[model samples]
Target: MIPSLIRMARSRTYAEAINLLNTCQSNAATIEAIRKSGGRMNDYAIVEMNDYLRRIGYVPDDLNKLNVVHITGTKGKGSTSAFTERLLRTHMTGRIADVGLYTSPHLCAVRERIRINGEPLSEEDFARYFFEVWERLEGNTKTIYPHTPQFPIYFRLLTLLAFHTFISLGVSATVLEVGIGGTYDSTNIVPKPVITGITSLGLDHVAVLGNTIQDIARNKGGIYKAGVPALSVKQDQEEATRVLAECAEEARTSSYEVVPMIPETALGLRGAHQRINASLAVALARGFLRAQGKEGMDDALPRSFVAPLAGTKWPGRCQRVEQGKTTWLLDGAHTTESLTSCGEWAWGEGNKPGVLIFNCSGGRAGQMLLTALLEAGARTSSSELVELGKRFEAVIFCTNVTYTDGHFSSDLTSHAIDPNDLSQLATQNQLRDAWLELVPGYDPKQAHVVASIQHAVDLVRGMEGEHEVLVAGSLHLVGGVMEVASLQGSLGMV
Candidate 1:
């Protein structure tokens, strides 16, 4: 115990703890294991995380006291979760002490993934609690079992930490965004969420989640438990919708309803797709408020709910900014599905000299994303849709890595890309080649590939004349831009 205590105490700064956390990041080996097994480890992982929480002095019932709204889906889950938090915080004024939000793959800081009342935990608080959990788990590992994982995986630990933080802070409510597909996700360990939502299911994480949309929907349905209200946007895939309903029936859910898009609800988040996300949020918030005994919650989509829902601010999703001569349109859309919406939003914003600054991690479908972007842009116009694609003056692809020396920020460095790939510029070159193939006669000079994010930003920032820069594809890439371009403090992207 003394050795464990010393080890934990050695990380005297938040930066040190972040570095240590990055080491726990899952590598290619883990991803390969998930792919081979089809990521059915959801149940096993929940049991594992549950045991970890117990070892750290938390039980399902203990966490249950902090009423939770658990949300999971392929896309828009993060944005939906953010909307629910704001509405709950506003509607439940004086009714709840704090609203704890836990989402994944943060744009800037890992701490940004866990926020209390829309603000990240301070560096001091993060370090203090980080070691508190780390030391406790270290000392109890062998005592709990002869063989256990050295520590919880990164996402699982962060989930436990969010629960721990909320419990320690005595928060009244928590809004959880599922780390992955539903059924066996760690967040599913909760005895019962007050309400659960599936936000627009699509074909994503096909290898780990499932091969088909129905399989993906079944896994997402894992979050539904007996007696909890289940809400969702009626999916376009009939089979996926049927499977989700079957799961709800199997769990004997309190109520399973398919919500419709609310018309003319001006959203704080840009794009037409956000209306669907907002609609789900409105339903989830209404269900949550009703559970808390707040009256006047009905199908009308309350007049009071309008203000708070519109006030919600989630960055890196159709977000816009003006940095001097450059206009930055940022959206963390990596999957083909979301990138379709992203491209539509970006192209609709302007038909000017634009440069697409893009990169994707985690084996994302880069070519499919690029194709989707062009297709979406073409769809937005009838007369000269081809002309819209030509409006993009340049296409920039680069690694999400911040520095050329192969060092990543303490919080952001956990990548699965092999060192060989970086040296060969495999990802960027693939993107560049894909762009060239998509555009016949496109000047190869118009497509630029840089070794690091800073270099990409420097090149574009130095470009003469007015420019529209679309930083799309991955949140990591958008986040790297924030760090290199000094947008974190200047724009408060965090």
Candidate 2:
């Protein structure tokens, strides 16, 4: 494997890196493993990830040296991670040299998942590090981790590459967001993040996770390492709070503090829920700074933290993008709770007529998300005005398949959808039906479906007059539309 790395290092261009990646990527195998087990989180993912890391000459301890700020939750993980990274960079840029950010589900490019100093790795650097890790594992999969997978799955590989890049670049601080629920998550292989945090937890990923909020909280709390400062947002329910405390004790961390959400906190991101996320970010930043042995890193958020927290900009989360004929209120809120907030944020403040551009990944929660959005917009009583439902005249559901050719961008190609869903338009149709039920008298003609993102953009482009289009439900959908609509290269929307 070492020899393979040396050989690939000779001339592994970006194209070859992508080819190797496509050949190696496989979610079907994991899905099959889950199906065989009747669908539960098992040792398979944990063993594969840790074994693969060991093959590439990395261990959990090595990752700990990167000074990680690990985070997980049902929502706001990315925004909290973003704020943590930006805030750390504010004080640690010159001190730390480089701050590595490892996140998941990139908007457009896989490079977006592995970043340093606020920018995604360059094509040349990404390909270099990508193949360096790939070939090393490829060479050893047959022998070193003989019983384990020869190549790590997509996210696992990126996780390895992120650690490699950060270490190789001499990074002093790292921000890590869990790819899934924390207990068996690929990123959880890191044993000792300097500070671990759980943002808001909710009933998301219920099939793999358990059926209840307490179940989800325990799973997310798995990132806590003993003797580390474990922080979390204050849970709304007593059971959730109890489960979090139990998990904290189970993990036996040095201390646990549930940071309270500040009321009316100014945040760069839209949506009211961001105030809590911002508060968590503030706590994480303080913990990270204190870990560096920096003086004045006391309990309070430094006066400097406010500007970055309030001014932080995380792309595509409740962002507003205007192009040509429409104003896009873009958010990647897929869960019921977040989507409810998105609906209120979209309709509660504005009076202009809206057109909803919505799609969720194939999940059981699709109907629930749609219901939450509609309820958010609907009036609870006769005297109360109906403001939410009246904002949108059109609701479009489209597959996140980016191109008219029915192919996705290289980075996005790994999002597995059942072939039947693609052929039958199963999920999109499900959303359309749900929309009809929510708005009883609205014309079925208002609910539309398109083949690809290009078709969806064209449908919006053909609309008459000014319209506020709420692009919600999936980040992939928003990113696909942005790529097709030529909004990616625009100014000041981030």
Candidate 3:
């Protein structure tokens, strides 16, 4: 049953594979087919994994041969994954083979989710593997999961695809970023990884992971397998340490290492948070090498591999661009916590006021961000700061971030708030009105709305001023700005 499904899945084109899967609405049959072809995860109890593997003809034999690095957290997962992948590439040898990197929420393309040494999977490769796994399942069986039964989720299938692709490609090491909560996340299929790392924990994905830092930390910590070396960034140190310690004990963890993060690093990527992320990646890589009996592997890996990260290019995180005489900063700080931190960072002590261009999705923590910026601006100058917040001389409200339909589209007219209008209202009223006005379609419940980020960029480009432009909200938003800037030759053109 599994072999036939594999053949069928492999025979289709990339588009066909996607269409077939989409047609099934991700039913149990599709999932079962995926499982038969080698899909496994921690959500299934130990007994379930063993049973599924046995029934599906998966031996879990490759666990010993593979070097797996699992990274989980609310934020900085991508940066950490990229950093770790790059460092490993610099050190490891043997044909200098491929490294598997799996990141979630692909910005532009589905293939972006799975890359081998920074290149997306070839179309033929993706199609071949899709069928290989599909044919391996028993009688093309499908199982109905409780929750939304609308086809197996795209991420689930993509996760399986990544695993199979990594194996087939003979990748020596695979760095996986957990899609959502770690415990039940699809990527938890790997029995034991060489090392597990967690980036900073925040209050996102509240519905699935739970609210509060500790709750989310516990969920992310689920990626830590028994006896596997685990490293984490500096978080709510006391609470995080305590929770991780408890988890380590329960999992019979071999060694638990905490990265001693320096607040300041020479890394081009700024923000105190990035320092912690870099430290976590460095410590995890060190532990991974040490476990592989490559301890003190200096010559094998370049000193620059673990050197203070510089020239790191992560889109949407304080990315700076210059157009003409204006300095345009782009960041995708969506959550309140991230936005507030970014706001404070932007309005650093003795910094010059500039034009602020921003937008937010429905139910986004925009109010908190506006408040933070206002407070930061207020501290700098009683009148000028207030005026800066009010006038926003070059403010443009546009959308091109994460949309409900999983596509980039924004409606500027909807939920548009003029900075000038905001300035006149009392501080508290301004915040309230801004929050209400920014609500897309004046509907807080609907997550779908449109805002064109390009429009905002055009507005900025058209403006005549020596002012710096600050673009913040979502990574998707930042990516748009970068894309536009790149096309316009405006990146660092100042």
**What is the C-alpha lDDT profile of model 2 across 91-175, one tens digit per residue?**
8756434788888777777777888877888889999898778767756755344556567666677888888899888898999
Cα error, candidate 3, residue 434 (Å): 1.9
Supply the global lDDT for candidate 1: 0.79
lDDT of 2 at 363: 46
Question: Residues 100-136, candidate 1, lDDT per residue (tens digit)?
Answer: 8888888778888888887778788888888888777
What TM-score do all the candidates reach, one by one? 0.94, 0.90, 0.72
- After TM-score superposition, the amount by which residue 243's alpha carbon in candidate 2 deviates from its true location, in angstroms, is 2.3
Ranking by lDDT: 1, 2, 3
1 or 3, which is superior by TM-score? Answer: 1
- Which candidate achieves the best TM-score against the true structure? 1
Give the top-scoring candidate (lDDT).
Answer: 1
Q: For model 1, where is the 10-residue window of minimal lDDT?
A: 485-494
